[model samples]
Target chain A: MQSIIAVSELSKVYASGFQALKSIDLDIRPGEIFALLGPNGAGKTTLISIICGIVNASTGGVTVAGHDIRRDYRVTRAMIGLVPQELTTDAFESVWNTVSFSRGLFGKPANPRYIEKVLKTLSLWDKKDDRIMTLSGGMKRRVLIAKALSHEPRILFLDEPTAGVDVELRQAMWEVVRSLRDSGVTIILTTHYIEEAEDMADRIGVINNGELILVEDKNELMRKLGRKQLTLQLHDPLDTIPDKLSAYGLELAAGGVELIYTYDTQGEPTGITALLGELQQAGIRFKDLNTTQRSLQEIFVSLVKKPA
Target chain B: MNFYAIRAIYLFEMARTGRTLLQSVVSPVISTCLYFVVFGGAIGSRITAIDGVTYGAFIVPGLIMLSLLMQSITNASFGIYFPKFTGTIYELLSAPVSYVEIVLGYVGASATKSLILSFIILATAGLFVPLQIAHPLWMLLFLVLTAVTFSLFGFIIGLWADGFEKLQIIPLLIITPLAFLGGTFYSIEMLPPVWQTVTLFNPLVYLISGFRWSFYESSDVGVGVSLAMATLFLATCLVVVWWIFRTGYRLKT
Candidate 1:
């Protein structure tokens, strides 16, 4: 149950004076699917780049399983795998050679059986002998995954793993991730797809403007941040909210044909009962009534905006 | 760095420039034959020998060295630059390999290509004019040194370049012109005293002079000085490259 990856006060500043990461501190647990969500240029990729040893951090250090990434780089790097966002591969090389070569890069001994298994797991075995340039975009991506996993790393970093990929391939990738996780591989994924994280991540970390704003269990974050809205389809058109309805923060909607009431489910009382009673006293009646709950998508949008 | 990994990377790169085998092994032979036809066959009718050596034979070493130097720099520089421009460098950078492995693998392949081209050019030159190996050992040593030195130089150039065009600038504009002006087609001794002194300043002169001296017994430069100059040039290049790798100058950041 030790932290598989740790970052303390890490920051990255580019040569153009752009602050890519600012005072970030977080730790990822072993064998957990940790998804980092953020908008483009929000330092999610930068943070991953530093930990993957592809880019140098302007300040601070990161460690993988107690090995300092910069000082003990070989040991740290050997223990981790990174599938970069770019579709970069040896175009003229066969899928088999590319994955086998990648495994060799980690100083792993030749294991054709393992390479074949990785290719088959990614659905790339049939295309194993085909040149990389001839493969489709999704197939090439699968090859990158096979290459990343060929070395049998304990931790894997997939940066935007499903970008430009089809739904079927993405689902397949998710299954691969799940299997890897089941086998005790710690996964730190950065994705723009909120649903991908919402569906798969045990814990979610949201980063913005080079800062990590929040990290919490998926269910806990959703329950704590999610809000519900109560809607009333008024029987008669109301010109404005009544003075008595001021106690409840109800918003008139659809040109007075509907009223929407927002409240936290975690509150002592949602107050829908009291609001309905007050509406009756104020001569407010609805033809139909329903309530809708907020999702992680909404909470994410709100968190990205300035605190209000 | 794992040796097998380096070998794998080297073979992978060799495959990368697969098309270059045509250009490296074939193009140089064709180019040398053309040079022999126009410069050696036609020009030899009037000019006999520069200094007791046939004009065709005198320029043979220069022509071979010319292609070797140019091919070495272009092959190595373009080799690295294309991968960077094409975004394949990210795959390499993200791998669990070290920068040392990358350099050794790339430069090793480049050296192999340069040697291959150099020897082919030598054989092509033999078809036109005979070569006198006054000191076969020194000749072989000089060829190896020149190939390795320029290969390392080109590897650095490859890393420093940002674009495909940038990779060609040094060889097309600087190195080629320097080779011609350094008296690859002519002898410095024929020039006036001031021009001869000026030719000494060009680094290519030392390389070509050493190469030519190895073939001719009555050469002006000594073997020791030639080897020393070549060694110093190579050592300087290695140090700069090592420093760049250490700093990760334009690479990581």
Candidate 2:
């Protein structure tokens, strides 16, 4: 299938001499939730900003649904919806007006029914007549989402949609995202929340210092790059790691009451049995042990820690 | 830009500005009343009428337009500047709105406001000053054009303002003083030759002159010269605002 969103060799150099995006090429498929994960100042917002036409790109080109973002911005922008991180709405404006105005901004014909559907989908129907400033933070976020969806865009960009929102609201937002994807909307959300991406994203892309490090299927990214951990609860508290434990790279924790050993999950041998035998021989005994596969959060941290 | 969308944005902006309706109604009334008392009553008592018009009558045109100019610019500038201050411009920018739509919507709403308030002040002026309207249609025409010109100038100010401080600086420091010196409460012909010439540089003089010309059947300053200056001021404001929008100055990175 042709990529729904294609960015070729994209780069951004800010006026303040910061190179935000560094010649990064990326493609996003239709009907999938693609999460762009990165650290602070990692070009996540800059990349999204450029694609949304909020910021101009220094080099390279972006095409959405086959329409160029630069040369044919109106159609490309019409096809895309961007929910920015800020909760900036007309403070005195009713929720309905805010969302409707957003649709009108896209040159869409007035369709009250369509607007109502969007508000109901985001659970903003009840507050449609209420002023924006009076709504709670999460409700305001829902309004932002409603506004983005007002234009019925095929591609939606959520820039940290769940930031500063409560867990319940986050879960609510994820449900909305899932339904949107089910309805064939392509989603690209940039976030530091790995669990959100882990739970929702079909594919994950890691960006650091304006360069994309890797983009892979969720399961493949975990299985290929994830590292497992063997955490042993010590039967006896000790001052230091035993000499024999050095080879295993064991880290003493909580005054030696627990030990953590990290190993690559993709390695041919996990070597847990050999490590236990060595620990027994070294006079270290644990009543219980637990093994864990790498989480998306850990994978994200390690990926960003790597050199740009 | 589509008219429906522009109206939507315009109505949305007007609603936001409606919160200041009290301020909008009160500020001009208070200022006009004070000017009427101080300049019209106190100063007029000291000097006789000019061109057989009372001091109260002389200030009617200038006072009404002053309210129009101040309110139009303040409202437009604040409307745009507050969005940036509150970080709401990001939401606006991300929307599928064009620069022209943004300008027309904002400036249009402000122009509407100034027009409405201009009528209010003009009505209020009648209660205190026995001002004559030789041509009510002409008066309304001048009122409208004055409002439009100032509203456009205000739109440019909105784009030029970066912060709250920056927003108020031009209106407070520049526009206010120039309006004061632009023969708002008096005629430039009454001033010495050099002061009258100095007052000629203030573009507001032409705006006030155009407005005053409509009040009486005749005018001391030629109507053509005043209209030409008003047109020039309006054109300059349009070019500057269009340039700002096209360049995406401060709006885009």
Candidate 1 residues lying further than 4 Å off, grouped into runs, are: A230-246, A251-261, A272-291
Candidate number achieving the greatest TM-score relative to the actual structure: 1
Q: Per model, how many backbone clashes are there?
A: 0, 0
Question: Candidate 1, clashing residue pairs?
Answer: none
How well is each residue in B67-155 modelled by candidate 1, as lDDT tens digits?
88888887788777777777767656766677778778888888888887788788878888877878778888888888888888898
Best by DockQ: 1
RMSD of candidates 1 onward, in order: 2.7, 3.6
lDDT of 2 by residue, A131-232 (tens): 998999899989989988988999999999998899988998899999999999999998768888999999999999999999999999988878888899
Residue B97 alpha-carbon offset, candidate 1, angstroms: 3.0
Docking category of candidate 2: acceptable
- After the best TM-score superposition of candidate 1, give how far the Cα of residue A56 lies from its true spot, in angstroms: 1.4
Q: What is the DockQ of candidate 1?
A: 0.53
Give the candidate number with the greatest lDDT. Answer: 1
